[model samples]
Target: MSSPDVPSMTGVHVVVMGVSGSGKSTVAAALAERLTLPFGEGDEFHGERNRALMAAGVPLTDADRAPWLLAVRDWMSAQAPTGSVVACSALRRAYRDVLRGALGDVLFLEVDVPAAVLRARMSARTEHFMPVSLLDSQLATLEPLAADEPGARVDGSASPAAVVEACLAAVRLRCDA
Candidate 1:
């Protein structure tokens, strides 16, 4: 679906979420550019403690993520008047709920990929703090968004451009509804 056909975001917040290596940041960036919205990388909100833990190849507990999620929520809330796209590894339902509390009209775009593919991507990636060893824990903690949730799921195996297209199509469909 083309942009014009989608509900015009007089003001709507979109979140792109997935586990590590699922291309949330990449897809969010492209979507933000295409939609002419501001982009926020969720990783940037990670506190120093969380960053240190992840850098040491340790998986974060939910407590470790709460503050980070709240910060992102605040950012999203602040951007509601202008609209924004945020890239977050919102691996659990509660996390999504927290975000929804701040931005009621939030739309989640989930990037889905197999663990094996994600592992491969993590292994090949450089300069990223998230380690391959933490992938299993993330997968374990993940609670996928229900179908009734205002969201779209895109296969991460496709090229980035294709994934972006799929995301746009899903967003358009949801907005049109």
Candidate 2:
């Protein structure tokens, strides 16, 4: 920790990002639990229109996503003093920029998974509104974390436990790793 009074995780915003069905929510929630931070489910920020579009297998455009990103950004800002772990698709660099704009140094944890695996996961899932048909759109729109971005990437193909372990390591900002 930077100071005796502060927790090491203080003000550390980690956005777990990936395409639909890539396990962003699972990894992020577990990471938050491990770090004892609040967790935000990105999908919950989606407007009714956005949800409807994804449910219909339609890809969301930048214009369509602007408000939703702002909402997520605002939520992060609200938790600024405490820090948070949020799961967001963050499919494009622009989307991530919105998040970073809210807090100057938000960390992004990109979860990478194969398209086939994403398809299988989306198909097997019964809860999410995102459809398997939209997987291609998400895959095509995904932009890996940029070199200048403050973040880390992990293989989402790993078990949920392994994914959480990897995320926790990154969120700690350890020097040894």
Candidate 3:
């Protein structure tokens, strides 16, 4: 169901990444469906303790996130051979490196939105374990993808469809190269 103008995602494993409230889940799900690829929810990989910590407005230490990152890496690695997409907050270069190490040349789609939009989005969330109080920490930790990274950034303020299209285009460009 992808538009003809868009390139086919034959072997691209995409990580839809950003800080909290950047629409990673929405964009990643749509992008995966558009490409007809399997999708994984990064939050689902979090251990109960991590979830609890976040729910209580406590920021996770890198130590707390390490095992979670490995779990996400393993999940992405399993899907990489077949081409899939996952929604994750791989906010740091080191985290992306972990995923790249596992998947081998993964493309990251970083969704960047304005702080106001992020705060609004966070305020509107209900069932999510991540609280608005933790967004500042997440944003503080977010490191934009390095120049050498194989990925592009999309505007999170755009419509989900537009964002998905942009992501597909980015993946096409990266994979074609």
Ranking by lDDT: 1, 3, 2
lDDT of 1 by residue, 39-134 (tens): 999999999999999999888988899999999999999898877899999889899999997654899999999999999999999999999999
Q: Determine which window of 10 residues in candidate 1 has minimal summed lDDT.
A: 1-10
lDDT by residue for model 2 (1-177), tens:
243322376676889999988999999998887777789999999999999998988889999999999999999998888788899999889899899976535889999999889999989999889889888888889989998888988989999999887777776553223
Candidate 3 residue 30 C-alpha distance from true site, Å:
0.7
Top candidate (lDDT): 1
Candidate 2: misplaced stretches above 4 Å?
1-7, 174-177
* Cα RMSD, model 3: 1.7
Candidate 3 residue-wise lDDT, 1-177, digit = tens:
457755556556789999999999999998888788889999999999999999999999989999999998888777765677899999899898888876545789999999889999999989889999998999999999887898999888988888888888888788767
Model 3, runs deviating above 4 Å: 1-11
Backbone-clash count (model 3): 0
The per-model lDDT (C-alpha) reads 0.89, 0.86, 0.87
Write down the lDDT that model 2 would get: 0.86
Per-residue lDDT of 158 in model 3: 87
* Cα shift from native, residue 80, model 2 (Å): 0.4
Instruction: Identify the candidate with maximal TM-score.
Output: 1
Instruction: Output the better candidate (2/3) by TM-score.
Output: 3
